[model samples]
Target: MSRLLSSLRDGKGFDIVLVAVPLAFLLVFSGLPLIYNVVMSFQAVDMFSLGTFNRPWVGFKNYVDVFSLPATWPIMRNTVIFVVCSIAGQFVIGFALALFFARGFPGSSYIRGLFLASWVMPGLVVGAMWNWILAGDFGVLNYALRSLGIISENIFWASNPAWSLWAVIVANIWLGISFNMILLSVGLAAIPRDLYEAAALDGANGLQKFWTITLPMMRSTIGAVISLGLIFTLQQFDLFASITSGGPANSSNVAQYWAWEMSFRQYDFAKGATISVVMIAVVMIASVIYVRSTRHEVRG
Candidate 1:
C-alpha cells in the first residue's frame, strides 16, 4: 500500500490516474448515452419498450419512415436555412465588432464586456425577450422599422409563416454574436502587429491590409468559429420552443425541435431517435472540422 501510494504521488501512475478519472466519467456520462441513442435509433422504441434494452430491431425502417414523412423535407430545409443564416449573420457582425473593439478607443473594453449580456442570458430568457420584440403590435422592432419608413404597418414576426423562422434566426444571431466576437478578438490579438506595420510601409491601403493580412491570419479561427456555429445552431431548441413552438403548420420546425416533439409530445420515440441520430451525424462532422482547425492553429 505504501509503494502504491508512492507511485501515485511521484510516478506515471499519477498521470494515469488523472487521465483515467475524466475518461471514466466521459465513458459513463457522454459515451454511454451517445451509444445508447444511436442504438435506440435502430431498434423499435416506444413508451412501453423504453425501460429495457431488449427490443425488436427495425433496422432502417425508422430512417425510411422519417424520410417518408411529408414534414421531413421542409424541416430539413428550414434547419439548413437557420444554420446558414444564423452563422453568417453572427460571424459577419461579430467580426465587425471585434475589429471595432480591437481599435482600443475609450471605454471600449467596458462596452465590449456589455455585449456579453446576451451571451450570458439563458436561451429561454433570450427567446422570451425576442418574443416581445417581435410581437405583431407594439414591438420595438416594428416601431424602429416604421420610424425608419421601411414599413408602415407592424410585421407579425412570430405568427407569419414567412417571418416566424427569421424571427428565431435573428434572436439566435444576437445570442451568438458575442461568442464569435470574443473568439475572433483573441485571434486578432494574437496576430503580430509588425506585419501590419510592414504592410503600411509598402503603402497598402486599409482594405488591402484587411483582405490580405487579417483574413489569412484568422483562417483557422474563422474555420473553428464557423464549425462551432454549425453545431450550436443545429442544437438550438429553446428558441423554437419559446418563440414559435414550430407553429403555423410547422413552418419553423427544425430537426432538433421536431425530434423533441416526436419523442415527448407525440410519443413517437423511434422517429425521435432517428431524427437525433441524423443530427448527431451532422454535429460529428462539425466536431471534426473544429478539431482540425484548432490543431492547425496550435501547429502554426
Candidate 2:
C-alpha cells in the first residue's frame, strides 16, 4: 500500500490517475447519454415510454418516418443554407479583420479585444438584441437601409418567409465572427515574419505574398476553423428559439430546432432522437476533419 501510494505520488501512476478521472467522467456523462440517445433512436419512444429504456425496438422506421414528413426536406435545406452562409460570412469577414489587425496598428489590440464581447455574450441575449435591430417598423437596420437608399421601406426580417431564415443567419454570422477572428489571428501570428520579408525582397507584391505564403501556411487552421464552424452551426438551437422559433410556416426551421420541436412540442420522441442521430453523424464527420487538421498543424 505504501509503495502504491508512493507510485501515485511520484510516478506513472499519477499520469494514469489524471487520465482515468476524466475518462470515467466522460463515460458516465457523455458516453452513456450518447449511447442512450442512439438506442432511443432505434426504439419506439413516445411520451409514455420516455421514462423507461424497455421500449419496443422499431429499427429504422423512425428515420423513414422522419424523412417522409413534408417538412423534413425544407428544414434540411434551410439548415444547409444557414450553415453554408454563416460559415462563409464569418470566415471571410473574420479573416479580413484578422489580416487588418495583424498589421499591429495603434490601439489594434484594444479594438480586437472589444470584438470578443460578441462571442462572450449568450446566444439568447444576442438573439434578443438582434430582435430589436431586425424589427420591421422601427428597426435600426431598416432605417439604415432607407437612409442609404438601399430600400424604400421597412423590411419585416423575422416574419416574412423570404427573409426569416436570413435574419437568423445574419445574427448567427455576427455571433461567430469574433471566434473565427481570434482563431485566425492566432494562425496569422504564427506565420514567420521572415517569410514575408523574403518574399518582398524577391519582388512579390502583397497579393502574391498572400497567395504564396499566407494561404499555404494557414491551410490547417482554415480546415480546422471550417470543420468547427460546421459543428457549431449544426448545433445552433438557441438562436432559432429566440429569434425565429422556426416560425413563419417553418420557413426558417433547421435540423436542431426541428428535433427540439418534435421532441417537446409535437411529443414525437423517437423522431426527434432519429433527427439528432443524423446530426450526430454529420458532427462526427466534422470532428474527424478538425482532429486531422489539428494533428497536421502540430506535426508542422
Candidate 3:
C-alpha cells in the first residue's frame, strides 16, 4: 500500500496537480458565475430595494419582458445581422491576408507590426480611432473618397441606418483579420513542406494545393480561430458603446449594449441579468456547435 502511494505521488500525481489548477479556477469563476447568473435571471432582482438579501421570486417574468418589448426584437435582429455579416467578412478578409502573409515578403516582419497594431490596441482606442476615420464631415476616409470620386464631399457613414451596420461591421472585420492572419500564418508554417512538394509533383497547382492541402491541414486551427472570433465579435460592446453608444437611433445597439443600457443606464438589474443570461445562452450555443463541428479537444 505504501509503495503504491509513492508511485501515485510521483509522475501521475504531478500531472494531476497541473490539471487541478485550471479546474479550480473554472469552478470558482466561470462555473459559479454561470450558475449564479442563471439563478439571478429567474428572480426579481431590483436595482433599488431590499439590499442583496431579500428579493421577490419572479420566475421568467424578466425573460417575458425581454421577449415582449418592441425594442428587444430590433436589438436582437441587429445582433444577428451584425454577427453574421461580421463573421463572413472576417473569414474572407482574414483568410486572404493570411495567405498573403504566408508568402514571405522582403519586409514582412516590419509590416506585421504595422498591420496587427490595430488589433493589439485597446478596444476603446480602436473604436475611437475608427470613429474618427469613418466620421462623415472631416474623416480621412471621406477626404480620400472625395479625392478619388467615390462619394461627393459629404457622405453620412453612420447616420443612415442602412450604412451604420456596415460601418460597425467594417471595424469588426478589420479587427478580426489580424488574429486570423496570425493563426493561419502559424498553421501554414507548421505544415510539412513535403506535402506541398508532393502535391506539386502530382499536378496540384497553387489553387489546388491550397484547397486540398493547406485548408484540410489547417482545419482545426481555422475552426478554433473562426469560432473564437465569432464568440468575441458576438459579445462586442466596447466598439459599439464607444463609437456609437448603440446610437444614431438605437440602430447600432447589440445584445451586450442593450444589456448594458438595462443594467447601467436604466438601473434595471433584473432586465440586465435577463439580457446577460440570454447573451450567455447565445454564446454557449455557438460554442456547442463549434465544439461539435470542430471536435475540439478538451484540455485538462
Candidate 4:
C-alpha cells in the first residue's frame, strides 16, 4: 500500500492515474450515452422496450422516416441559415472587438472581461431576455426600429415565419459574441509584437500587415474557433425551446430542437435518436477539425 501511494505521489503512476480518471469518467458517462444513442437510432424503440436493449433492430428506417417528413427540408434549411448567419455575425463582430481591444486602450481588459457576462449567462435566461425584447408590441427592438424610422410598424419577430429564424439567429449571435471575442483576443495576443514591428519597418500598411502577418499567425486559432462555433451552433436547443419552441408551423425549428420534440413530445425515440446520431456525426467532424488545428498551431 505504501509503495503504491509513493508511486502515485511522485512517479509516472500519478500522470497515468490523472489521465485515467477523466477518461474513465468520459467513457462511462459521455461515451456510453453517445454509443447508446447511436444504437437506439438503428433500433425500433418503443416505450414498452425502452427499459431494455433487446428491442428489434430496424436499421435506417428512422432515417428514412425523418427525411420523408414534410417539415424536414424546411427545418433543415432554417438550421443551415441559422448556423451560417449566427457564426458569420459572431465572428465578424468578435474579431473586430478583439482587434480593437488588442490596441491596449484604457481599461481594455476590464471592458473585455465585462463582455463575458453575456456569454456566461444561461442560455435560457438569454432566450427569455431576448423574447421580451422581441415582443411584437412594445418590445425594445421594435421600439428602437420605430424610433429610428427603420420600419412603419412593429414586426412580430418570434411569430412571423419570415423573421422567426432571424430572431433566433440574432439572439444566438449575441450569445456567442463574447466566446468568439475572448478566443480571438487570446489568439491575437499570442502573436509576437516583433512581427508587427518588422512589418512596419518594411513599410507595410495596416491592411497589408494584417493580411500578411496577423492572419497567417491566426490560422490555427481561427480554425479552432470556427469548428467550435459549428459544434455549439448545432447543439443549440435551449434558446429555441425558451423563445420559439419551434412554433408557428416550425419556421424556426432546427435539428436539436426537433430531436427533443420527437423524443419527448412525439414519443418517437427512434427518430429522435436518429437525429442525434446525425448531429453526433457532424460534431465529430468539427472535433476532427479542432484537433487538427491545435496540432498545427504556430506557437509564438
Alpha-carbon local distance difference test for all models: 0.95, 0.95, 0.81, 0.92
Worst 10 residues of 1 by lDDT: 8-17
Give the per-residue Cα lDDT of candidate 2 at 14.
86
Candidate 2 per-residue lDDT, tens place, 14-36, comes to 88788899999999999998998
Q: TM-score each candidate.
A: 0.95, 0.96, 0.86, 0.94
Candidate 3 lDDT by residue in tens digits, 132-188: 988888888899988999886676777777678778888888887777777667778
Compute the lDDT for candidate 2: 0.95
Stretches of candidate 3 off by over 4 Å are 1-29, 289-300
lDDT of 1 at 247: 77
Question: Candidate 3 has which clashing residue pairs, if any?
Answer: none
RMSD, candidate 3, Å? 3.7
Residues 8-120, model 1: lDDT tens digits: 87884788788889999999999998898888889999988898776899999999999999999999999999999999999999999999999999999999999999999
Model 2 poorest 10 in a row by lDDT: 8-17
**Models, CA RMSD each:** 1.7, 1.6, 3.7, 1.9
Error of 1 at 116 (Å): 1.4
Q: By lDDT, is 1 or 3 better?
A: 1
Evaluation by TM-score, superior candidate among 1 and 4: 1
Instruction: Compare the candidates by TM-score and give the number of the best one.
Output: 2
